[model samples]
Target chain A: MTVGLTHFLILGTILFSLGLYTVFAKRSAIAILMGIELMLNAVNVNLIAFNRYVAPESHIGQIFSVFVIVVAAAEVAVGLALVISIYRDRISTNVDDLDWLKW
Target chain B: MNFSLLSSEMLAAGLGTGLLILGLIAPKTENRRGFGYITAFGLLAVLVATFFQYGINQSTFHELWIVDDYSVFMKQVFIVAAILVVLSAVDFVETLPRFRGEFFALIVYALLGMMVMASANDLITIYVGLELMTITFFVLVAYQLGDGRSSEAGIKYLILGSVSSAVLLYGMSILYGLTGTTTIPEMLTKLTWSPILVVAIVMLIGGFGFKISLVPFHMWSPDIYEGAPTPITAFLAVASKAAGFAVMVRVFLLGLPLEGAVDWMLLISLLAGITMVIGNVVAIPQTNIKRMLAYSSVAQAGYMIAGLMSMDAPGVKGILFYSMIYVVANVGAFTVATLVRRALDTDTIADYAGLGQRQPLLASTLTICLLSLAGIPPLSGFVGKFYIFQAVMDKGILWPAFVGFVMSMISVYYYLNVALYMWRDDPKDDRPVPVPGPAKLVIVLSLVVTVVLGVYPGPLGELATMAAKSLF
Candidate 1:
């Protein structure tokens, strides 16, 4: 059986689901960051596959995917810096520890 | 490149970059008040420039950026919000342990994001503009690194915000796959009702729901509001949420096929109803003022969404007018809170005792702001609510409007409760609460606008109507 757009979409969906699960289940902030990265990668895959199969003439999808990669990188950098700052203050990277502002 | 068409955005970007560079070269001990003043004045100038471009309709760069009455009206609101934030923030920024000049510059960058988001005609531009704004907010929220709550709020906002953006992106990808274009109008032409399209739209709405803090997606707001600096909280509450609505109007009203296969309006009305109920009900129990306002802001968004669900010219006009009033009223309220927080180092409603006697001006200003937010007559919020309800009533969507009206009445209890604390309760410590000059100016200006607009809303109303007309 030859792989096609449907197969690529299936793989992308699975990766996205796993990433979302990791984000919700993981305690460590770094692990959650990894989850977010995974989700973004899934989106990138979807973008490229669509660009190749659906709209091969226009580079809009390709350009959008590139922009997504750049934005994701910036988001992770800011996320890590914030995590490190919180870690320095509380000495823990667990999500539970950052509950100072809870109702 | 038609430089004249893009002058306002260019001015904002140039000034923001200039401030960033100046912030680096300035000495550590230099007073940062000048930076705030420059930012406020520069933004005001840019706002004036935008007024000249208001009637000149143009779309450039592959139709990604459009200059029209709607964008111009929204840009004016954002510029005004930015000016108020910077002016009020001068005293607060001065009190930080380390005053970085980039604080002022970051605000300009965020304002630039909002301005771009207002005019974004393409999906790619919207995504980019939104990320630019949110990323700047991440830094601004954590600017006070010595404060633990600030850093915690920053991290929480970052994680949640990125997840939502990724979801929004996934939705955009699906849309692109189906339509094969990122341009909103082109995609609108090609859109057909498919299960996948519904999924994409739902995901997009869900993503925007997080930004505007409608009910289920609002878990992070109270924490972030209670933790982030007061001015930044005010920014997030007012300008950022307005941008979200701008995108919503652009995407849902203009881009999506509202009258076609899918009934997105009903879904939106459901969200609006739930949001109004939850936001008002939850606000009643909050003792912390920022947290309380966070819930109130949520409820406010619900009211605007109710107007948006009308999906007509009147509905869009109501949204525009309501957003303007909300910026003035809410910003004024937060300015008072900021002042009290500075004086007392607390944000509890109980601690606001005897504030009326101690600081008559601030107490009165806060009262006006809160009453306006509660939709009391003779204030801007009342007129705003009137417009919104009238629009919804026109569209024959009475349930949500009834919910909104009842919620506004319920909201009056908590809003006036703050006034009760200020006026009824006796002073614990009777030292007068001093109001700084700039902050006092911000409060007075916003209060005047609030009342002035309430009494004679014809000018802004006409502008809002004009702005609404541009969408179709």
Candidate 2:
């Protein structure tokens, strides 16, 4: 059976749902970073899907998806660095403790 | 849509790579000021290249990046603003303990993103450029993460900014679903007001709203501005924010068939009203100069939003013109704030007491900045305000114009509080030191241009008109 747009979207939907779950359920900031990564990858799936279905003839979405991957890697590096340092300072990676400013 | 890549992107990219390499190769003790000088030269060459590119009537690359009068106009503004920011940061950045080449490199990266954003005609390209900017900013804010405030600022920005991006991405998906295209002109021909696309508009506004620090979505701004280095704050307030505005204008005008335009205009008008009211009123009670200025930036953004919503020749032109004025006035304010922070070791308004007596040059220049920011006559701020109001009046938005006028009046109290502390002879401390020549030069140059622009805005006004016409 040929994988159509809905099939790709269903896969992306699963990835996005998993990402949302990671964001809400994870205590570690790095875990949340992973979740964001998942979300972006899901976006990539949708982009390539659209490139396949809508344009079918052009690779605009695929090209953009590649750029997105590079950006996502950069984002993860910076975010992890921040999380590591925050963990060092506060000695906890739980996202809940970040509420020192919640007056 | 491929012409030669904008020289701004090339210069900024070259500078970033050079900084990364130099950061690895250079000795720790060598004069790091050379990095600043090199970056300044890169931006200057880009500035020259932008004017040269302007000779072409229209240029497009890959159907996603377009260069016409509009983007070229903003390219010049962003480059000039960035050049002045880097020049003024020489001593400020040098003082940081762990100053590496990455600081300047990230700045150039952010500027490249800003230029790309200004020129982007594709939703995907705009998203990439915006992310590039926000991520660089996430680092630039916490460059001094050893400090608790800096770390806190970074965290705040990250959480809020991430959510905004997600919403924006979702909005992009909706737009794609609706129009089946990410290209701006294609979407313009295909835009329809389904329930989903309307929701997408809201999401898009929320995303851009965070960057611009407009009301109801501006919570992270004051903390981040205060925590970041002053030069980055200037960049955030001026360039990155303008870059967001650039995309907002393109999407609403050039990227849509103007359907649902009225509703969006009304919504933006309401946002402008609240932004002005909240920004001015909240600033009155803030003791921290940076925070006050941050709120004031929110108010100034409201004026620009009003200009964009007006959607006429003058309305669009006014937004561009006022943005130019804001770059000068805001950088001037931040410059004085940096000087005073050096002198008094605090940003508290009380620290400014008897500044006129202690250091007349610094105090007077700061007064000029404050007055201009308050929209008093014969300063660039006044001209900026007048142009925005003229646009609103031209659009016949009487209620919004009234709100804007009233907010401007309320704004004067806080701004004058700054001046009252400056020029008042209540010597709360001992004497002051002489201003450094470079810092003084920034002040004098900004002040002189402020006066010149306010008195004769015709030339710049014409440029704004021409720039706005390029949108169509």
Candidate 3:
């Protein structure tokens, strides 16, 4: 029952699946952004676990996770800005309301 | 590391930053028209500097960055695309109420991102470059403050784009775990097929598929293309897709053991076939010109993917050559659409009635561009199609090539429908469509390049062959 690579990988996969579920199920745009952040964090967990267990001598995975965090921040910043803009226009943040262009 | 190897990237980055600073320092009363010219000329300088780096096969920064003829050639395609977009966008940008200078700056930053993607040799480098390009595009797509469609498009792009990046990164992490390295060349040496590796490859394809807008993952594209500013749409069609293909070729062909344990060719051929059929068939009914072009570009991407079926120098050469021609033809078509949108304040196909009478230059250029896209003879698109199909046939993969050929024929129907509307119908308005000097230059230049490349593709063909050889 030790917390090994398998344990971390299972945890990561579950987080990723839940995040994807949130992305698909959520109607609010902000909620979708939160789901994306969770998915990114799932990736971070996977990277850190792999770096620790599989390639302990190198720091590529750790560094990559750090890069992922920074990029996710930037993405959220832009996403929130876009959401605010949409909110201003329609007073709504529901993904369903974004039907001005035909899908 | 020889810093000279980074000269082009540095120049592009500096130009983007310098433009932002210029925006801040310049008087608000001063017109922002100069920003477009400065961006275009700066990109031209960067393009020339990239040419100087040609034939230098080397890697630096611990193999994170690479410089070779293949990357150099792709960098040129991106710069040429950026230059055309900047020039065509000058008039369009002038119409924007604010942040006009920032428009040019963001385009330059996107160009820088594309250049980095072209040269990236490590998965980390590729991820960084891809995000830089995609994030900048999110802003550019949403730049039109008054247009709700633009903001909606931005939100759609941001959500999907981030999801795709996460998928791609997850695949990369898995690959790193299995191979214990992130350098593409190193991974090639270390890779062995396992069930997990299959999962990783599928994730990677899904991620890249979204970027290139291959059929099933292509749902977001037409909406985004229709809503984004026309110039940015043009950029998205030509440059962004080219970057995706360039990196896909590198990663799939080089990083993976495609020759062993996986029939990646069969998988890719299936996707390419479906993409061609769906993209072209769906395009036939679109009334909006931007959405039509979006689907057409998707079909065009399918044809390019057909070239990848071979995974050899000839296949790679076909892709490189076709991408260059695609930049010319798509920019030409989109520039014409931009002008039409500006003059008429609409992008409908039926609205283009009697355009031949009102603006013969635009009507004719649009016809040639669309005809080229439809792969008519004596046009660059025909030659591009020829090379791609020829490469696929040489590999003895008949079905995908056949599918591509038939799709091209199907595409001709809608393309010519627009031509017919332009030439045959009566004018909705009698006013002449005024063409700006820069727009006129872009149209004529695209026309000349398209024709010249078709008539004699030998020089570029040789260059493409050389670039393709460098990859192997």
Report iRMS values in order: 0.7, 2.3, 0.7
For model 2, the docking class works out as: acceptable
Give each model's whole-structure lDDT.
Answer: 0.91, 0.79, 0.92
Cα deviation of A95, candidate 1, in Å: 0.7
Taking chain B only, the TM-score of every model is 0.99, 0.96, 0.99
Q: In model 3, state the lDDT of residue B149.
A: 94
**Candidate 1 all-Cα RMSD:** 1.0
B1-472 in candidate 3: lDDT tens per residue? 8888889999999999999999999999888989988988888888888878878999999999999999999999999999999999998998887899999999999988888999999999999999999999999999999889999999999999999998888899899989888999999888877889888887888888888898878998999999999999999999999999989999988898866545566677788988999999999999999999999999998999888988899999999999999999999999999999999998999999999999998999999999999999999899998998898888787887778778888999999999999999999878778899898999999989998999999999999999999999
Task: Please give the distance, in angstroms, between residue B71's alpha carbon in candidate 1 and its true position after superposition.
Answer: 0.8
Listed models, DockQ each? 0.87, 0.36, 0.85
Cand. 2 Cα-lDDT: 0.79
What does candidate 2's lDDT look like per residue over B330-414, in tens digits? 8887888887777667878888888888877777777787788788888878888787788778767677678878888888899
**Over 4 Å off, model 2:** A1-28, A94-103, B260-262, B431-434
lDDT string, candidate 3, A1-103, tens digits: 7889999999999999999999999999999999999999999999999999999999999999999999999999999999999999999999999999994
In angstroms, how far off is B112's CA in candidate 3? 0.7
Instruction: State the interface C-alpha RMSD of candidate 1.
Output: 0.7
Which scores greater on lDDT, model 1 or model 3? Answer: 3
A-chain TM-score of every model: 0.96, 0.93, 0.98
Off by over 4 Å in 1: none
